[model samples]
Target: MLRNAASLSVTVTALVLSAACSDDGREASASASQPTGVSTAPATDATGGTTDAAPTSSGTATSEPTTATSATATASTDDPVAPKFDIGGKDLGASTTGEGDGCKKVDFLFVIDNSASMEDNQAALIASFPGFIDAIKTTLSEVTDYHIMVVDSDADGRCEQPCVMDNDYQEFCSPKNFHACNANLTECDTTRGAGVIHPVGLYSSNKKCQVFGGNRYMLPEDPDLLATFACVAQVGTAGHPSERPMNGMQAAVSEALNAPDGCNAGFLRDDAILVITILTDDPHYEDEGTPAEWKASVVAAKNGDETAVVIAGLIPKPDLGCAGNGMTQGAHWQEFVDSWGDHGISGSICEPDYAPFFQQAVAVIDETCDNFNPPG
Candidate 1:
């Protein structure tokens, strides 16, 4: 449950009395007693109105009033207006210590959109990656074991046109030109072609790689973590123009479950927290299945313990408005996040900097870990 610090306001009243006196030190009585006055202005500083000098009256004081004004005033310290740890105007729900035997492990799957328009977003994410890791480490003392993997948002099942080896990461084709003639060249697929970089192939297909000593886990302590992430994350613009990130994620997880000695076989642990973060600017294709189905796929992969999963997203937010350039309100992405309750957090993908997003995500993860109910 969420805890709040309450500020208490107490009102204290002090009685003051004054009278006019003669030169002989005898009281010069007034016709009648003046009414008592009270200052109700709130103190604005920590000194509690003590620092400023008090005003003096010309009349000499004889004795204080015997009749004291007795009144008690109490102001609620609880902020009825705002919460301290709010994100994008939404108050985070009552936190729960996630189900686990301590926060020993975490499995992070980043489904990055590697389309034509995601270059800047990708750069921001990469630059902020270290901060995210630092936050996890800072909170947990040390994360016992964590696996990080990347998959691009392209699961269209159709090969992109004229696929070839243009980039250095292209293991799909060789250096030699497959299509060439006296002018009018016809581009053709090599033996591996489209499937080589496909999400399914990287995780579930027979062509799945044994990059980590015949397994798919990439440790946080990996010597070349950034380069490795960048390699897989840069899926390039050669993929089909229409993206299916939900389908891609589903395929990746499904492959991890079914493939023989699959890349993701040992990554998902029984006690580990699973964080699946999607970075996309477009909406999920309707043909890729609804958000419910995708969520179910994740739950199933995590052994039906919904407490073991956190699905965060960095996509376009509504009010900030992704107005320019053929962008929707990211309603479909928001729909996916809404289904997860406190298990999900969504931030704007249009921000030029992703540091705040990373920090908040890390903080959320830390809070989730703190709420986890460890086994006996």
Candidate 2:
């Protein structure tokens, strides 16, 4: 029910899900389409319901480059508009002195891979994760600070397919609804039938805030969000449990490049930038080790330099990824992802398009721009 997408360039969008009820008649919400003002955040009291953030390194940015990924905005239909900058560069003394200057701040981590043949990518992220927060609040209407997590890298605590584990995760087990019968009260109690998918939106960016979905309890992007979707069902969504393949965007870019040292955009905010997109058609298999130990687990989940911008869609390309049509080989795991594009890892092969692949990944977050601002 989700593959619908209006897509791109600074503005003009739409997302609709609205269906109510949920007590006996059975029906929750998915509702979308709303872009006016924008400022959301708040709704996390996690504690082994397991929010597990905690990674804080630091650096910075503003903006003003020209040819790296070629930045331009202003396309409006619902939201793309962004342009008119002081996005600074040459490290302009680490920029930002005025109203968040061209507002960089970003931290998005989605390391999804639900196994069990990924049950249609976990039902396309439970019906398009509410059009991915309605395409990021229709292009950042002040995302109140932005922080979204959606892990399932072979889950950790409960849920194998209607869970009830005791792996020492302590209390709050899963599976057995009829009102969790007694789950300390009632945050969720659907008998644990909806695993292979948790790690939803995790609100806190601006104006409206809330996240947690797979069946529904709270899913707001903006509509006066006061805080709700805190369902927190952390587990392996389905069953790929052979273990040893958890790269959940290298643990959400090491918590957005080690955030904390002054923390601005929730993580550490030296202009803040950390975006990992990892969708999956399954192919990073890595035989558990040895491609130099799986490229050293992707360079230790990219702890190298600039920090975060992982992008790995792998949807349904392979006709040589038709832009001009390109596909000599590579589609499964190893060979010709454009011949490994010299291993630097640029992207292209998109065709399945679930909302223009989240509006071209929110217009490729210019880590100070140099190439993909809109290039790929």
Q: Pick the candidate with the highest TM-score.
A: 1
Model 1 CA lDDT for position 184: 28
* Model 1 CA deviation exceeding 4 Å by range: 1-100, 156-214, 255-260, 284-287, 323-328, 373-376
TM-score of each: 0.59, 0.26
Report lDDT (CA) for all predictions: 0.46, 0.29
**Candidate 1 lDDT (Cα, whole model)?**
0.46
> How many clashes does each candidate structure show, in the order listed?
5, 56
How high is the lDDT of residue 142 in model 1?
48
Local error of candidate 2 at residue 301 (angstroms): 16
Report the lDDT tens digits of candidate 1 across residue range 12-87: 1111223222211133332221221111111121111111111111111111121112112223347433112213
TM-score of 1: 0.59
